[model samples]
Target: MKELFKQIPSVDQILSKKEIKDLIDKFGYPLVKDSVRKSIEKVRDEIKSGKLKEKIPEMVFELIPLKVEEVIKPSLKKVINGTGIIIHTNLGRAVLPESVADYIKSLSTCYSNLEYDIEKGKRGHRDSHAERLLSTFFNVEAATVVNNNAAAVMLIINTFAEGKEVVVSRGELIEIGGSFRIPEIMKKAGAKLVEVGTTNKTHLEDYANAINENTGLVLKVHPSNYRITGFTKSVPAKDIAKLCKQKGVVFAEDMGSGNIYDLSELGINDEPTVKESVNAGIDLISFSGDKLLGCVQAGIIIGKKEYIGRIRKNHLLRALRVDKITYAAIEKHMELLLREKYHEIPVYNMIFKQAEAIRKEIEEFISGFKLENSELEIVETSSKIGGGTTPEREIGSFALTFNLNKSPEEIEQYFRSREIPVIGRIKGERFLIDFRTILKKDIPILKNYVSQLLSH
Candidate 1:
């Protein structure tokens, strides 16, 4: 055992090796040295446990760099989403349009008038960056942006309903992705959550009876992730707005998945657009910029200028405000939407995609590549508007499926472990790469990776 320990190279000796020098250049000297010390200690422990029988210096040299990289691999990386779910929250929620991404890069690398008013030759407010574009889409008096919808809700509730009763329906108290519950957020904002009506139904009179002098705001939360069908009834936004007006209370809606375009033209008619919510006489409204808006993550609030002015005066606004890059992304995204270039946006492109086009692309890919040890076939699949947008509405789509000797889980892991990881879904016994969600530029990359995978 003692001789086996001696056979393992010293940390200093390993650090001096030429290949180790290459690792130092890549990972820096301090990290490489720390990794070498830990590896040496691990080798000593393995020898003490009688796991090593001979000098394996060659094996150690061959694996040391990989060990160091394993310790330093970044958790966040660019990955391909083949799951047919657009606006996938786990996969970065929304992908910026190519033009929007390029705009952000250009603005970020240099400097722009993020706060400068070149017209006035003085400082300007950053809210105008996206707020101006959003106002044209709705009849809103004013708008402001925060980091996310949750932050928007918290900020608005704190601004108007703190230490007061916030009347809401028990049916509308939704919990979206990551366990973000409506009641919990209201509590954090110091609002008294007074849940009214049943889990399946809520009426206009229920809200009217709940309001009193102590009532500050009536919140209507959109069930963006789930649905209750059959024998269910809910109050319309206009009726609630009228009731709030009569009671002299603030009425706001957390209209999740802030859609700006008319998706009904594309055969999706379930979700109501942000413009409809604005025209419903709602005194205040907020929605997510990432889900259906096809932009960066932002919580946009628009309503009466009086309430917006009050919100801007709140000290918490500073904590919840977005940075320059986020403003830049949202502004450019709004420009694309205003131009009616829906295809330029990733989320819209996926929603607007036809199943036939995806099939043709899959056929072309198959004809070009020679993948061994796997059978490729085209399959019909369904895509979804994920990130809690429109739930249960399956859009027609297509996938390139693979049937290999490996198990489904093993095949998924294999693609997931690639340099640019491919996240495909396993349905039945086959692995699927849905073309509806795949970007046009990524098709060649997918073909090359699959070839390398099966050729081995």
Candidate 2:
């Protein structure tokens, strides 16, 4: 063991080797040195543990380049979304419109009026950029944006209901993704949560009864992720707004998905739109920009100018404000929405795409695959509107189910091992490919990947 340890080359000697020197030329000195050190340490440990059978120099030389490549690989590389969950949170919620990337690139190359007003030649508010667009689309008085939906909720609570009672129904107190409960958020924002009515039912009178001198705001939360159907009753937003008006308290709603247009036309009738909430006379409303809106992640707050003005003045607004990139993307997405270009946005396109279209795409994808032992067939599957929106509703979709010679787990692993990993679901001894979430451009890539795997 001592002789084997001594036989291991020094870091300097390893770096001087032709292969490692080539890596140094390609990557850099620091990375190559680190990789060599790690490889040497690993080989020494293995030798001590009696696991290293190869000669020390051969093992160290072989492992150095692999370690260097591993170290240089990016952590946030993009992956193909074969999973039919539109707005899949883990795979990055909403795929922004390609125009958004163009906008970002254009902005990246040059400076723009992110804050300064070009006409006035003076400092301007960043909120002014998207405020008018949001207000116009939603028919609200004014609008502002923050980092995300959670920040929107927190800002509203901290601004209006901090250190005061914010009335809400027990049923509307939902726990969003990652254990973020409504009650906990309220507490964090310095608001006293006043729960009214039972989980299954909360009437108008319950909200009216909860209002008192200490109450600063009446909050109505849209439970975006889950639905509690069958014999359930809750106070409508209009009624809640009316009650808050009578009580002389602020009425605010946290619409989780931030839907701009009515999805009911596409058969998703249950999800409400921002227009409806604004029409209901809710004084303040907040929603997500990334979910149903098909834009980058942002928390859009639109409401009466007086209330939005106050929210902008809150000290925490500075901490939760978005940067130029977000403002730019959102502005472009809003323009697309205004122009009625629904197909431009990926989320809307996926939701409204015909089942027949997806099936055709799948047929093309599977036609290129000549698997000796794998059988591919088109099967009917349902795609979900994920990212905590419309939990119960699933868009009708088509999938290519694969009955491979290998186990389902092995097939899944094989696709996952690709350069841009293919993420699909497995069910009942077969691997499934839901084509709704898979873009048309991704087909060639998928075909090449599958062909390569079969050839191997």
Candidate 3:
């Protein structure tokens, strides 16, 4: 161990190496020096653990550049969604319409009327672009965009129920992705939580009993990630809205995975459209922009002007406001929706893509796809609208099933480590790359990766 420690090059010695000098030129001296120190530390650890069989300084020097590259490499990159999860939260939910890229780029490269009203040649609000578009789709008096749906929830709760009681159904208290619970958010917003109803059932009377003089809000949370099966009963949003109206209490809903598209024809029937909630007379409602909306990350707040106007005035809205890039992406997405070109939206495109259409594409790809060392076949599978929207609902889809001498885990890792990671799933001892979540253009890219994997 003493000899191995001595053999490991010092940070200075490693930085002086020709390979590392080139890295320093590329990434600068501080980053290369840091990487060299990390490489030397790793070497010492490996030697102490008996993982290093040889005490060679050349071996240490050889890895210093790799460490430098890893340090400088980006952690966020493009990934192929072959997992059949459309609104996949882990993979950046809501694939924006391809048409929005140029607009986002144009705004990013140059500044326009992000806050300036060009028509009046004076200062203006940035939310006007998307807020104007949101009004046309929903029967809402006002709207605003925040950083995310969670922030919107916090902002609204703090604005309305900070010093009062917030009534929520026991069954409707949802823990969304990342363990963000409704009760916890409400508490953080400084609202006293009063949970009504049982886990499986909550009635209008329970809500009625929970509301009183101190009740400032009745929050209805839609659990998008899971479903309650038989014997489950929950009160309708309309009834709650009416009750809140009668009591003069603010009624708001955290409608998880807010859907605007009418997907009943595509077999996605359980999730209600955002228009229904807007039309149902909810005073305030908040939802994710990147989930079902197929836009950038934003917390879209839409409802009656009486409440929305108050939320807009909250100083916290400034803290939770989105930037110009998000506004541009959202503005373009709404434009496409307004024009009735819903198919241009990636989420809708994937949802509306029939199983037969994907199978046909798979069949065409499989006809010429040859793997000398593996087996590939077209198989029936179900795609999920991930990102906590309709968790139990499955869409009919097809996948390219893979069977190789290597374990399914090994096969999965091979594709996941590619230049553009191809994320898939393992089930029934087979690895499947579902085409539902994959764009038609990406199939060829995947084919190339599979072919390259075969060579290895």
Candidate 4:
């Protein structure tokens, strides 16, 4: 054991090797040193456990470069979404348009009027960039934005209902990603959550009965990720707004995935639009920019100027505020919406793409591949609008099912090991690639990837 341990090269001796010197030239010395340290630690542990028994120098030299490569690899690389779930949260929801990306790049590299008003030549509000567009698009008096929808909800509660009672239905208290619950957020905001009615049914009278002098607001949360049926009845936004108006209290709603256009025309009826909520006379409403809106991640709040002004003044607003890059991206996204260019956005393009078009693309993709050991076939599959929106509805889509040489898990791991990882779904012992979420430009990359894999 002592002889084996003595063979292990010291850090200075290892750094003197040709391969280690080459690695130092490629990646800086610090990274190479860290990799060498890690490799040495791993070898020591293995030797102590009696697992390492051969030539030690050869093993250590061979392991150092691999460890260096692994250590230097980036964690946030882009991956192809072969999975049929659009706006998949795990895959980074809502791919932004090219224009938005270009704008973000430009804004990130250089300074802009983030807080300066060019026309006024003085200090201005950062929210002013998207406020006019949001006000015009949603037909609201004023608007503001935060980092995310959860922040928007928290800010609203802390701003208006802090140290006061905010009535909400037991059924509408939803838990979103990361185990973030509504009541917990309300408590964090220093607001008293007053639960009204039962989980299955909540009447307008229940809200009216809950209102009192200490009641600050009546909140109606949209159940974005789940649905209740068969015996569930909840108060409509109009009725809730009317009750709040009559009771002289604020009425607000947290629309998790805010839609701008009516999706019913595209056969999706359950997802309500922000336009409808604004028309219902609600005092304030909030929704997400990254989900159904197909933009960067933001929490957009739109409502009467009175309530929005108060929300802007809240101390938490500074902590939850978005940066200039977000403002630039959102402004460009809103410009597309204003121009009535729904198909230009990635999420809408995926949702509204015809099944026939997707089938054609898949056929073209398959025509280029000459498989030796794998069988590929096109099959009809259902694609979902993920990101906690429209849980029960699935859009009609087409997928390519690959009967490969390896097991489903092995093939999936092989694809994931590629430079730009290809994420797919496994069904009935086969790997599936749903073309609905894939962009047209990604076809060439996918083709090259498949060709390389087949050659191997």
Candidate 5:
């Protein structure tokens, strides 16, 4: 290696335009000439520092070119959501329906009615598209949307209670997924947070005692990411609303991960519905469109027409307003929910799929995979409503478990890096392909990918 290094010229001689172009051709245009030029510059700097022992510079030239491609590539890309964690936050929570996608694509190329009232021939509200549908679906007097649930809370607090006290249960001051804690948001919104009780227990008295002349709002936040059990107490939205009404304070319920449908019929734990919260006579109720509602990234506020009107007039509403694409998608999703087209929403379909159908699908796929003397079994597994919803509920599911020649981790990584990633769980030293969340159409694509990987 030392003799080979001696025979090679200085670092400056190796990086010619032709050589760089050759490397560019090998790696696609994503890397190309810019990466090679930068790598060459790095090597020159390394040589000046007396770090080049011939082979080191060549190695540096080779390595830095590869690193540059990775450094410049966009962090966001499409990944198949096969982890069975529907609403997987890290993988872009809440996959929009095909109708929503088509609508977004249709409006992208042309001018839209986003801010124009066609009937009146005048400027219009951006929330007009989704507002009526949301109101009808949630049974509220009116509705408005912001970019996300966090922003929705911020807008409400800043609009109604900035520089005033907002009382909430200590248990309800929960941290949502992604470290977005409620207290932090309240502080940033310029509202003073008054904690009312212990983490596991909070009473209506806690809220009543916290209310005083300067208190502007009574906030009740749902602990979406976690649940407390065993000797626990909570104040219902109705009770809080009554208290707020008597005290002349604004009532707001942060219905985190609020779903419109009843999931107990689908064998999942019972979660509070948005309509129920609204019927509690609260001044305002806020929930996420992406989680249980199964829509786009939106913070939906539904309440008394007057309060929603105030929220709409807030200056921050402009900064947190949803765009045309979001309005289109949210409108379509709400329509589907109202029409009872439950199957159209992928998250609902995955969660509510029958266990028997999942087993049959797994059996059919297993029959196609001739394992070459390897043993495979369609074992019963459990699915979950991940993305920090329903932490304790496990749905019945089926999985295809096989003993592969490659290590389980290696096979898992292979699927992860494949063009269409197949994320599944590994159990008892075997990779388990859970079929509850896997769509029927995805089965063939998965089979082909596995066959290709095993063949190589």
Candidate 6:
């Protein structure tokens, strides 16, 4: 067999450069001459070794490279977020508003007053954009921002009590979204961790007993992810503030997943507002920008003027300061909030949307897909406030459910393989695309996907 295969002309010997170019021209740029040549060479090598018997009809397929421009594309492409998870942490939480995106695009294109005061024609601070607006909106004396909430907390702890003790409730010492624990962060800041109370219960006396000569700050951390249901007790910020003030200690709060607007009107759980925290006489307060605030990722610290000034002077401030683009976005977000334009915030809109309104949208979208006599259906569904905000809270929503010719797993795989990935939860052996987290604008995209499914 080997001798006979050798006698027959090898694929490399049979196919010439001109022949390959002819094939490429017929099949478009995908049939690149170089790739075709390599394929033929491999085929020739395999045939000469008498391995042809092991090959199948599928082995005839050839992968050719198109133009370099077509082959190489940008990694940061737009992806469809159909997972019904809002503020999806993995897919870059809290998309910037169109105006904010434009602002960043402008800065990226040319030079601006990022670190220079254009009016004064002199060097200036980059943190200037967000500082004033953040303070004004949150009702704080001053404010500063960092890369993230954890960075803000570390910078605060390192600044105020590097070598001293920071008293906190053991229950409040929580592990955030990532495995980043509070106690570990404090230790890294060179502050002694003085934990107070038990896992489910803590009292003002516990904090009082922990206080002593080494005590520099009384810290309160908000349990962002989980809430203790029954038989739970903890000291309020007002009481802790009074006790800390009497003992000459700075009372600081880490209000993780910070919120500014009232969610009660939207039928969401009423979380403590940032203004309330500041009003409780806490000296320093830090919270996140992206979570409930519906802004870009940043750690916002707002508190008394004197304490903010001290934090600004700390050596770590320079390292943790936010960029001009972040500052601009945060400033714009605050402006919208302060002006009572809640519709501008995407998160608030998604959470507050009524069931009737969402149902109407889904019904309109399904109408576009005639389904070629296929049985397409719209059913009532439930949506969640994802990103670890409310685990048990499910908002009323609507979804387009139907029976596909293929199996449930096949339908899911097909949707995912589209130009834009559509991720959703599966229930009762059916895949679902909940419209609760989906915006009205994304309906056209969903329609296109449904059209593709029907065609297939």
- Sort the predicted structures by lDDT, highest score first: 4, 2, 1, 3, 5, 6
126-239 per-residue lDDT for model 5 (tens digits): 878888898888787888998888999888888888999999888888886678988899999999999998989999898888999989788888778789999999987888
- Please, what are the lDDT tens digits per residue for candidate 4 over residues 1-456? 777788889999999988899999999999999989888888888788999987888888888998988977888898999999988999989999998899899889888999999999999999999998888888889999999999999999999899999999999888878998999999999999999999999998899889999998888899978898889898889999988988899999999989765667557888888889998999999998999899989999999999999998998999999999899999988988988888789998888888999999998889887766547789998899898888998888899876657788887888888888999999888888899988888888888887776666
Report the poorest 10 consecutive residues by lDDT, candidate 1.
54-63
lDDT of 2: 0.88
lDDT of each: 0.87, 0.88, 0.86, 0.89, 0.79, 0.77
Cα-lDDT of candidate 5: 0.79
TM-score for each model: 0.93, 0.95, 0.93, 0.95, 0.88, 0.84
* Model 1 Cα lDDT, one tens digit per residue, 186-287: 999999999899999998889988999999899999899999998999999999998888889999999889877677765778788888888789988999
Q: Candidate 2 or 5, higher lDDT?
A: 2
- For each candidate, how many residue pairs have backbone atoms clashing (under 3 Å)? 0, 0, 0, 0, 0, 0
lDDT of each residue in 280-397, candidate 2, tens digit only? 9999999998898989999999999999999988999999999999999988888888888888899988988899999988887777766556467899988998988888877889
Candidate 6 structure quality by residue, lDDT tens digits, 1-456 = 555344443345434445455655665544354455455565567766777654422233342333322444565666666666677887677766666677677777676687898889999877677877888887777888898989999988988899999999988888867798999999999999998899899999999999999987889998877777789898889999999999998999998878665667656764678888888889999988888788898998988889888888998888888877787788788888878888877877777778788788777777776766645676788876666566666777887676877776887787778777777767787777777777667678878888877877
Which ranges in model 4 have alpha carbons more than 4 Å from their true place?
A: 16-22, 371-374, 453-456
Error of 2 at 444 (Å): 0.4
Say which candidate scores most in lDDT.
4
Candidate 6 Cα outliers beyond 4 Å, as residue runs: 1-71, 372-374
